[model samples]
Target: MEPEAKWNGSTEQVEFSRMSPRSQGFTKLPGQKTCEKSVLLFTFVLLISVVLWGTLLFLFLTRFKKIAQDVEKLQESCVYHNDSGIVTIIRRLQVDQWDLKNDVPQLSKAVNKLQEDQTTLKSKASQISQQVDRLQEDGTTFRSQVLNEKNTATQALEKLQEEIEKLWTEFQRANGSVCKNCPKDWQLFQKKCYFFGNEPKTWPQAKFACINLQGRLVSIKNKEEQAFLTQKANKKGSWIGLRDLDMEGEFIWMDGSPLNYSNWSPGEPNNQGQGEDCVAMRANNGRWNDAFCRGQQEGWICEKLATC
Candidate 1:
């Protein structure tokens, strides 16, 4: 096995074997050189891409930061303006509230005063109404009293007028130049003055009283004269001039006149025990009756003719 020994042509194998790995790699095959060139070109392109990307990122960051700062300032300005507006609104609202508070008590006091005045007015109105009613009552009473007084005064005035008329009549008779004027309390009828005596007297006394007065016992001539004497006679009857003193049955007048007209009652002149001698009007109708001449008292009617 040790017997074989060989020799190269020029020791080429020995030099190649002796070369370093880096020297070996430097020496490439034909295809390997092409691959290496390709690799180098790829690496160069990647480095250029990374640099371009970084530059674009830097520009974007700067622009974005500037925009953010501007946005922040704008937001601050807006917030400040909004706060000022809110403050103004709040101040206005507070002022309004203060004004309302100040006016509330005054309004309430005014209302209370109005209510009190209304109450006072109501009381005064009621009092005025009552006073009016009282005044009306007083007026009614005064009117009634005035009416009564007027009625009484009217009656008194009428009575006084009647008395004045009577006085005037008396004055006319007293002052006039009448044919047959009557004295006080005497009445004139036709052409004669007549007196109706009030005192009770016997026939003789009655005759004397007539003579003193320039009159005689009434001698009724006719129906008219009888009616006048009857009207003047009292209710009990009054004595006339007719009597039967000179004769028992014959009747005559005191003036010496015969009995021309006689108005005798039914069944009268019976002489009644022979004492009835004088004639008197028995009733208001002028009926005649014989009465006692001397012993009995009687009213008498006297008459006198006119001398004018």
Candidate 2:
């Protein structure tokens, strides 16, 4: 029994130690209530924070989109204003250019009127210049004609003076030195008488024959010359004053001057082609006639005036 009692005592001691509450209280008593409350509070705060952050982010995104739309509308209004202002400026400039073009026709008409007046003045000036040239030519011709007339008048006056002096000397010579021993075949001029019938020849041969006698052919210049020579010839058919040997059919005297008045027989100087080369005077009519040079039926007479 003693031995059984000891083993039982050891087993009771082991079980009593296991069944005591003091060991369990000591392990759980330090951390059990505080840990449970802290877990619960941290879970509630995480849920509230998530809800507030999500609401604020949604509001911010919505306001940003509205502000961007307002900016787009304002830019569109500004573009329309700029386009309308440019169109108004271009239309006003076109209206001003059209007004300037309307005045060009009046300027062109004014220029044309000035040109027409200039042309008319030039035509009148040309006509006036032509008239002035014609008047100058006429004045030159009139001056030349007046100079020629003055020279002719002076020559005529000197000729008249010489004839008056000759008549005075001739009257003094008449019957003062009368030729008592003169020949019958000689005629007197101033104080000298000449004989011309030394030979019968043609006009050329007669000229040479007269030069040998220191004489020339007869020359009559005035009406007193006709009476003086007729009375001196003593009624003979003699070769006398006028002929046409120098200019054909233009009768001239021996002094190389033309005859203003001629003493010719009627129907004389027929110039018949059969040697009508000699000049003869008619006895009764006291006029000249053309005769044959070979005919010896007519003779010649001559006279000479003093040069002094």
Candidate 3:
């Protein structure tokens, strides 16, 4: 059989017979066969390349989508955890603020109480200071008054001493002029005179007799005076000037002087019988005793200052 060739668009087509030796020889040329085979191989390689590139692009797109979804889920989880932590912190801060608000008033009250106590202490201190000042003033006034009184008493004592000295001088002068010598029958000793009465009499009667004789019952001034009187009595008890007529247990001389010197016998002046107020000198030992004023009768002795 023979194949016909046609031309289209300025291209020519040739028909070749399989049984013809010329057509077969032309188709079997090496250059033409090689050209056809090369064309086929190139087309197949390009198609394969295009398919491989398309498949790689599709796989890349699918992987990118999956990775984006996983990242979005992780971001959501982080946001939720962060929100929970923030809420807890905010609640704790709110509770602490409430506690502070509750404590404020009590702290203020304590401060006010301290201030009141301080004010009261200051007032008390002021009052004490004023009282101390007044006490100091009074103490100063008292000390001044005591000083004045002491000075006045010292001056008065000096004046009284001077007056006493003057009176003593006048008494010495009078005694020298009035008593030149003792009277007859009266014994003299140490510028004084004494008379012993032999007649026994009551104490009061003896006191009056001595007064009438211008003398007092014998007041023994010292041991010498006492010894002199005791010797003159001549072994007889005699009433002395010593008596407690004004007060019990207090013997004073009839001359209104205190009895300074005493020669009392053992257990004497006992004021026996409750009425023994007059004092007498016992004859045996010249010691004194208390006797009844009017009930006992005894001899008497009188004494007067001697004349110059």
Candidate 4:
């Protein structure tokens, strides 16, 4: 049977038992479709909210772990055990910088003082070098002056000695001691006697003649003896005991004495004729001349010690 329908004031009403089986089933299908649509919309919204919450939880955990690690590093970097951060280390570094700044002026002053001392030492060294040079110069001058004075004093002493010798010779002669101490025709001077011979003979012949008389040819010792002999020769060329027969230009006496004193005439003893090995006192000035040993004949003088 078909369900009867009634019109209410604002809606139409159908009785459920009076409806046919196909119409009731059709009316129930519309209500069921609406309920299914509501359930599907609610499930989609819940799933979107769950996804958003899961992403937010993951981000929060990662950020918290990174912040903990940064705090641990800051703890390790602290300078003091009680310190929490880098502030104490920074303050100590600032104090060291201030100390270095304060010491700069003192270091500069010390360096400047060293430079001044170096300059003073260099100046003193230069002055000392100059003083040493001056002293050397003064010493050289003093040595030269001393040497000159010594030479002058030596020459004066030689002259004075010659004069004294001449005076002593004169005193002996004036005392008439010549005849008492010497041979008959011999002249005495200085404890020795000299014989002036008149015979003209060669040098060798005169030497032998003097030896036969127990005397040798005269060997004049000093200026005083030389003067006396020259006066006795009386401007005659006479042979003395001087000869260079053993070696040229080195005269030696016959009595084996050294020929210490010599009175050579200017430009004489020139070994004239190349065979002049014998010496003769010049008749003109009593200076010495070298003559031929065997070719020239000359007067001779003999000398011997007096009888005391």
Model 3, residue 280: distance off in Å is 0.5
Candidate 3 residues 1-308, lDDT tens each?
12333334224322332357876687678898889999999999999999999999999999999999999998888678876797678788899989989989998999999999999999999999999999999889999999989967854664465356446645877776544377887887876778888788888888788767766688887998888877778477888888897799998886556878899999987988898899888886789988887855457898776655
Q: What is the C-alpha local distance difference test score of candidate 4?
A: 0.80
> Which residue runs does candidate 1 get wrong by more than 4 Å?
1-178
Q: List clashing residue pairs in candidate 3.
A: 179-307, 179-308, 180-307, 180-308, 181-307
**Local accuracy of candidate 1 as per-residue lDDT tens digits, 1-308:** 33333345236678888898888977776898789999999999999999999999999999999999999999898778876797688889999999989999999999999999999999999999999999999999999999989967864674465456446655666787456667766788886778888677888888879878866788888888778878887766777888998798799987667999999999999899879988887656778888888754447888875434
Best by TM-score: 3
Cand. 2 Cα-lDDT:
0.64
Across residues 1-308, which tens digit of lDDT does each residue of candidate 2 receive? 99899989988888877875987578777477888888898888888888888888888888888888899988887677766786577777788777767767887787898888889888888888888888888877887778767746643553454355457556655737433233455555544445656344455555445445544456666667666766655355666545665556777665445777667788988877855755776675668778765564244555444422
lDDT of 2 at 299: 48
Least accurate 10 contiguous residues by lDDT in model 2: 177-186
**Candidate 4, residues 184-294: lDDT per residue as tens digits?**
888888778889888888898998888778677888889999999988884669988899988888888765567898899999789977899988888967898889989
Q: Which of the two candidates, 2 or 3, achieves a greater lDDT against the reference?
A: 3
Report per-prediction Cα RMSD to one decimal.
31.2, 29.4, 26.2, 20.0
